[model samples]
Target: MKLQSVAIFVLFLSLFVSVFSDTARTGDWTPIKNLNDPFVQEIAQILLKEHEKQSDEKLSLVAVVRGESQDGAGTNYRLVLEAKDESAATNIYEAIFWDKSFTHFKNLVSFKKTYLILLFYNII
Candidate 1:
């Protein structure tokens, strides 16, 4: 019947919009540079250590420094990290924020915001 066909079409349209709309609004977050600073490296090592503690598999990590701002001759940095896990991904995120090595970064709040997106999947 036409009514059934219309209902199915509506459902498919809604699903398509829901899946693709987020990607359209927010561009993909890709790594710009590998973290090379000793401090940043320390944070990464801590995260990897935590991952190893939780799971036996070797963990892979990618660090991306996205933005920098200068105010009153002071520099602030925003970094995002992508971590892989076969079991729990959220755990890796929590460990990074809680770890002390990242404390010196003046913009932890903004950094957390950028990194949090890793928890969500973006279809593009």
Candidate 2:
């Protein structure tokens, strides 16, 4: 009985470790081709185009949903920005916020260049 209990405890410990270990892994963001929704696809394309313009910088576009109220009126977007240098990331954030597409959410999420780089560094 003691041997069986030890095996069960070891199994549970391994499961716990596996589940928490990958929290540090960074997820890859790939562009979705031929999305059924034209609106979402258009946004993605715009973000991709902006990213392409910054070819000298290491950047990627990621789609995410933002929310605040329980009614869920926050905006969804494909954001393109640098993940390394704080200055580059800030430039990208300013450019995106200045862009007409993201004018609405500018007040919602104060896009900080340093924040994104730190976030990516932490994840990786």
Candidate 3:
């Protein structure tokens, strides 16, 4: 009986440590390695749709430029996307989405236009 109690206690302690370690490393944004990942592209599409609902502008996702993810209560994805509006003029945007995978809940945290700086060279 005493041995069983000790085994249970050890199990609980190990579980606690595992959960704590996972929670401790969350909340820091990490760079996404695969820009061409289908899942990343899907997230970009989701962002465009959500943003359109709020802004009433029909935007289409052209590509997922880059992104980062931060884990916490949910995972927050920050992405730079290349997109075009109804008129088809391409533009860049920085969009953030918070998604809770377990519950399948997601929200568009923010979206705004971003600009790309272009440099030109001249040879004389």
Q: TM-score winner among the candidates?
A: 3
By lDDT, the better pick of 1 and 2 is 1
TM-score for candidate 2 = 0.24
- Candidate 3's C-alpha runs over 4 A off are 1-24, 116-124
RMSD of each: 14.6, 12.1, 7.8
lDDT of 3 by residue, 1-124 (tens): 9999999999999989987764436677888989889899899999999999999999998877778899899899999887999999988888999999999999999999865421111111
Give the RMSD in angstroms, all C-alphas superposed, for model 3.
Answer: 7.8
Best by lDDT: 3
lDDT of each: 0.45, 0.41, 0.85
TM-score of each: 0.31, 0.24, 0.72
lDDT of 1 by residue, 1-124 (tens): 9999999999999999988775423233333244576766655555465556556655556553332222232333334445555654522232322322244432233212234454443411
Candidate 3's TM-score:
0.72
Using lDDT as the yardstick, the better of models 2 and 3 is 3
* Full-model lDDT, candidate 1: 0.45
Tens digits of per-residue lDDT for model 2 on 38-96?
Answer: 65445544554554454544444433222111112334333433333324442333122
